[model samples]
Structure formats: C-alpha cells, structure tokens
Target: MQWDGISEFVYVAENESFTRASKKMAISTAQVSRQVSALEKRLNIKLFYRTTRKVSLTEEGRVFYQHCRSVLDGLDAAEHAITNLHSKPQGKIKLTAPVTYGEQQVLPLVNNFISQYSDIEVSAYLSNRNIDLVDEGYDLAIRLGKLSDSTMMAKKLGKRTSYVCASPRYLEKHGVPHALSELSQHSCLLGTLDYWHFSELEREKSIRVSGRLRYNSGFSLTDAALKGLGIVQLPDYYVEQHIKNGELISLLDSYRAPDEGIWAVYPQNRHLSPKIRLLVDYLAEKLR
Candidate 1:
C-alpha cells in the first residue's frame, strides 16, 4: 500500500481531531484533512465519523491505528539507533526530579554530566508533582521512594533513609520520643504525607501523624523542626549535618524505616539511547 498520507492519518486518529493533529504536527488543518482523505480513499474505508465539533474513529480505523503506531514506533527506534551509532552523545535530554532532591543532589550531577559530555544538552524540570514521562516526552526522571508505575523501567541510583529528628531545644522541652507510640504525645511537623514510615520487629510499619504545621517542602519542615516547633521526619540528606552539629537529634533508631530506593526512571523502549543510559549510570555512581 502507498504510505504517502499514512502518517497524517495516524496523527488524526490518535489525536481524534484534524485541527489538533495539524497543530501538533505543525501542518495546516486543511492539509491534514486532505491527507486523511487521501489515505481513506486509498484504503477504501470510512475511517472516521466526522461531526460538527468532534471526530470519532470507526472500528476499522482503531485497528489500523494500532498497527500504524507500532510501525512508526519501530521506525523511530531504528532511526535513533542508526543515526546515533558511533556518534558522541548529542541531543537534548529532557529530565524531571523532585524539587528538593533536584536542587540538593540531581542538579549538581546533571551539571557535571553536561560538563563531561559537552555535546549532550539537558533540560530539567523540578517539581513534586508526578509527571507522565512518556506523554511529557521526558528522557528520564529521578524518582524517590518506591516505583509505582510498572510501565516505566527504573535503575536504582542509591537509597534514601528517613530520619525522625527534632531540635535539641525541642527535645529538651517536649522530651524525646523513645518509642514510636510516644510520637502521639509530642508535637509533629509534617511534610506532604500524612503518615510516617518506620520499622517494627523487622517488618515495615506506618503511623498516621498529625501536626499543627504542614508544608510540601522538606526544607520548610526541617526549618520548623529547627525552631523547636515540632519533631519532623525528613530524609537523611536534609538533616544529617544538623544532627552532627548538635542542633538536631536523631531519634527512634530501632524503628527507622527501611531505606527507600532512589531511582532513575525512563520509558521502556526497544532502544534506550546512549545519552540516557550514560546519564543514569553517571547518577548511580555519583549518588552512591
């Protein structure tokens, strides 16, 4: 079969609108319509049910779309492999990470990666929100805790340990919590999550914690703890130095939760690009 307008047909089918597909593919709406018309004529089928404001694909169109998408994806993988063979890592690698971790850990490594591989460019988005890597076209993402989305492939860069800490003054005034249950009597400073993680009798445990103050930023929660507002649970990186400086005290050592993984996640594709693979490796080494 002729493949002249197959790409346009695929785009329209996926997007469910010629106008939106045209905008995405940077073509005119009329051109997109023309290409789809040509494709339908060649295939000799009614592909779409057009309406005044919407378009719906026919059953036959849906089946054809799946095959076309697979073919295009294969072609893209082959192109990526062929074009980048024996070539230096070059092209923009779009990445995302949590704001605190990105600022404290990932950003420095990313900068060094770019320094070493000058040909590889990076665009990083730092936020706490869960980003859809495939839909957003991210090359990779630095994710903390457990991997929830099974669709993405992940490499463990390192582990992050949560610390229950309080300022020396706060502990002195409110008394230290020797056991997990004692937390209920003490004022707690909370982050984004309402529960805190711990371990009991060699098994994982979670306790619902409440606080007068709650914020999304780890830095803010640590700050509140420092001012003797309440006890807070934060990652080791955020409070280790303070604990060492005798400004904060680490408590509940026996009950500290199992270390959670720090991961570099990317979509599962047939071909993983060298730039992404190398970057993940670099982060794993640097973080370890």
Candidate 2:
C-alpha cells in the first residue's frame, strides 16, 4: 500500500548502506537516507541498526526485506509477462545436449527455430555429461535415455530408437547375426559404451561388447559401419537412413531395445520463461 519510500528502503536494506543504495538508484545519498527515515516513521518500526562503520537490518527489517524482495521479484516477472505479450518471444536461452544428438538432430531444429524467431538467440553446449541446469545457469537441457534425475521437470520431446546394424558388405563377408549370441562372432565397431542394449521377453538387457574401433563419437562409429569395418549398435539417427537405403541392414529386430525418451529438462525449481516455454513447445511439435 505504501509505495513512497519502499523502493529506497529496500535498496538501502539490501545493500546495507545508504550511499551504495543511492548510487544504485542514481539518487543522492541524502535522498536515500530521507526516504528510508520517512518509511521507518510511517511504519513506526526501527528497520536498520546504523553505526559509523556498518549498517544492518533490525529484526523487523529482516522480515520486511524478505517480503519486499519477493514483491520486487514478482513485479519483474509481471513486467516480463507484459513485454512478452506485446511482442514475439525474444531472448537468449542457453541449453545443453549430448554431442551427437545435438549435432545431428537437436541443433538443426534449433537453427530452424532461431531463423523463425530472429530476435531470439541460442547458446547450446554439446556434451555427453549430465549438467546441472541450475548450478550451471542453463535455461534448458536436452537429454536422452531413461532419466535418473527425478528432481528435474521434463517434457518428452521425442523418442530415440537404437538400431543394431551392419553394412551389407560386412554382413555379406562376416555373415549376418541371426541371434543375439551371434554378435560375438562378428567384429563389432565399438563406441564409448561397451554394452549394447536390447529387450528380451519384456526385460531390458545390456550385453557387453568389444571391438577394434573405439571412439566416443557416434559419427565415427557410423562411418566405420558404412565402411564395412564391423557391425554397430547406435541410435536410429546414426543408421536409419542407411537402413532405408539398403546400405546397412537392420538386425535383431525381435530383441531391439524399447525406444528411449528424448527429453527437454529444466530445473524443477526454476520458472519457465515464455521464450523457453515456446522453444520447448516448438521442438516437441517439430520432433513429433
């Protein structure tokens, strides 16, 4: 209800110095001091304990500061909402994703999104490691597979199906794997992971695999598979086109693992800004 001295009082309380608050507000120190004094008189409360060296909040001031800070934050949010309503979604959003998927799938869509909303900018970090969006100050993150962080709020952007496949030349030369056990007989192009996932009788399974070519890169593994170096188990993005073109043959369809969820996750504790929310919706629509 009382707005006259609230801003100046809050500024001084938060900064714990009238001079600093004056500088922040672009006002004179005497004005800052007068406003806060008037606020204390109007409220009939001692808000600050001042000394020659330091100034700090009193018990009443601490309580007032808590509520005042929330009010200011709410006002900021309201202002942002009004601005977004009047204009197109425009802001920088920083996000993270696994390297291969971001490069092959997510980043291209992000490019398309930025083209549509030219005022918006995106900073995407492509990495395999799980990033703490809140701790790292990222607006969003695209993650794959079964999610382990129950604390994160996620939207299912899409699904990624893994394919167990080999080039026609490799299949012809090394013989096709008719059963899960037959994978051991052929040369397997390896990635960072040594285990190939599968599903058998409604149960998920991870079979340990080994090979001569090992790279943390999915593109390299796909190239190795195309060159007929060995069979590979990779996400469909890496091999689906090749399978459709008959350059690579999909194998073990009967035991293929269930499609893993591709998710866009943000800290559950954080607010979803309009730009980020729109971006998430846009991605889900395109991915679908």
Candidate 3:
C-alpha cells in the first residue's frame, strides 16, 4: 500500500482543518491538502467531507483514520508527514458574487488566479440573490456589508466605502447641501434602495431620497449625477475616480457611513477543497 498521505490524512482528521493540521505538522496547507487528496486517490475512496468552513471524516475515511491512528501508536508521527511540494493545485471551484462587484473586481482576481494555476477551473455566477451553497452546490460566495447572524463562516476580503456625490455643475446650479436635511430639496438619483445610508453623531442613519429617475444600475445612476440630473450615493468603486477628477463632488463628509466589509462566505461542515481555499487566500491577499 502507498504510505504517502497517511500522516497528512491523520492530522487533518484530528484537527478537522487542513490549515490547522499544516501548522501542527509544520508544513504548508497545500502539502497537507495534496497528501490527503493523494491518499484518497490511492485508496479509491473519499476520505473527508470538505467545505470551506470545516472538514470532517466520512464513514470510510473514519475507518481509515482510526486504522492509521492505531498503526501510528507504534510509529513516529513525524515520519508520516511526508513532503510533496511539487504538485500543482488542480480542481474545479464554483462560486458566486454580486453582479457589479463580480464584474468589476472579483472576476478579475479569479482571472489572475487561473492564469497562475492553469490546471484549476472556475465557474462564477453573478447574482444579487442569496444562493444556498449546499442546496445549490455552490462552493463559495462573495457578499457585501454586514453579514446576518448565521451558522455559515465568513472572511472579510476587504471593505467598501459608500459616497454621496453630485456633479459640480448640479451643485453649482442647485447650491450644495450643507446638512442631511437639505437632501430633501435636491433631486437624488435613485438605485435599488429608496434610502441613502450614512452616519450622524456616531449613529447609523438612513434618509429617504427621491429623484426624477430610478434605475437598478449604478452606472446609470452615476451617469445621471454626471449629467447634473441629481445626486447619488454609491460605493466608491463606482465613483472614486470620478470624484478624483472633479466630475463629482463628495457630499456631507462628516456624515459618510463607515466602510462595510466585502466577504467570502461558505457553508459550515463543507470544507473548501485545496483549490478553492487557495483561491480564497489569493482573493483575500489581493483585495487587502
């Protein structure tokens, strides 16, 4: 029988995490993952139930793990943790993200990751609806803002700031709003939400805003603001450069809401495969 991945498998079984097992054995998580995967392949049986959030043994995997642990009672544990760093990560990773962010930011990062790991394949679905990972068989999802209380695990990839802005031409014609209350007097470009979010005196606040035009698209709303049609509130990604070049003027600086997290969320007990885990880390690093 092949002995290549037994130690790695044992460690992962015990710790329920490739990352934790790697640290305990002083090896790369990639090595731990690769070994376990290799062991499963050699045995022609699945070893672990994998999810990005956690890992657990399957029935056959449990039996194998138990057998390995007993055999290890008479063997050196370190001897089982073999070094195999030559294997390139290769697998399919299915994920979902919000439409605009996926198009503008996340998919680009995924492209870079695929460029590095040519053997890995990915399928990304961009939608605003909250997809059930386990039910729909999605491996992971990118979510924005505050996460609701849930059993699912999440990692903050980065933060996004929202800006309330209007074209200088609009501000000049209508007079700039100096206080939150003044927003009522100006036409506000609308999006999916009828209210704009902000912070006032250290407390979160939302103010209802109405406009001559309402569209679900950020680009459309931004265009309306640039054309001096009205003011708009949107995440910085949509307006930061425009503000920088003086196409739009930031409003109520003191009332701007705190930045919200961009997150990578996955189902519990469904541990991320090595390839997906690698992508998550790459996304986190690049996003940071």
Tens digits of per-residue lDDT for model 1, 105-199: 99998998899998888999998888988668788889999889976778899998889999989988889899889999988998778899999
User: How many clashes show up per model?
Assistant: 0, 0, 6
lDDT of predicted model 1: 0.88
Span of ten consecutive residues with least summed lDDT in model 2: 266-275
* C-alpha lDDT (0 to 100) for residue 146 of candidate 2: 89
Per-residue lDDT for 1-288 in model 2, tens only?
Answer: 778888888778756789978887899999999988999999999999999988899999999987886787688678778877868787899999998888888999998888888888899999999987765779999999889987678999999899999998988888988888888887888887888999999999988887899988888899999999999999988889999999999999999999999899997545578889989999999876
lDDT of each residue in 1-288, candidate 3, tens digit only: 778998899888877899988987899999988998888888899989998898999999988976887676445333422322455678788999999999999999999999999899999999999897755878899999998847578988999999999999999999999999999999999998889999999999999988889999999989989999999999999999999999999999999999999999996545555677799999999988
Q: Which residue pairs collide, candidate 1?
A: none
Candidate 3: list runs displaced more than 4 Å.
1-86
* lDDT on C-alpha atoms for all candidate structures: 0.88, 0.88, 0.88
Query: What local lDDT does model 3 show for residue 197?
Result: 93
Model 3 gets an lDDT of 0.88
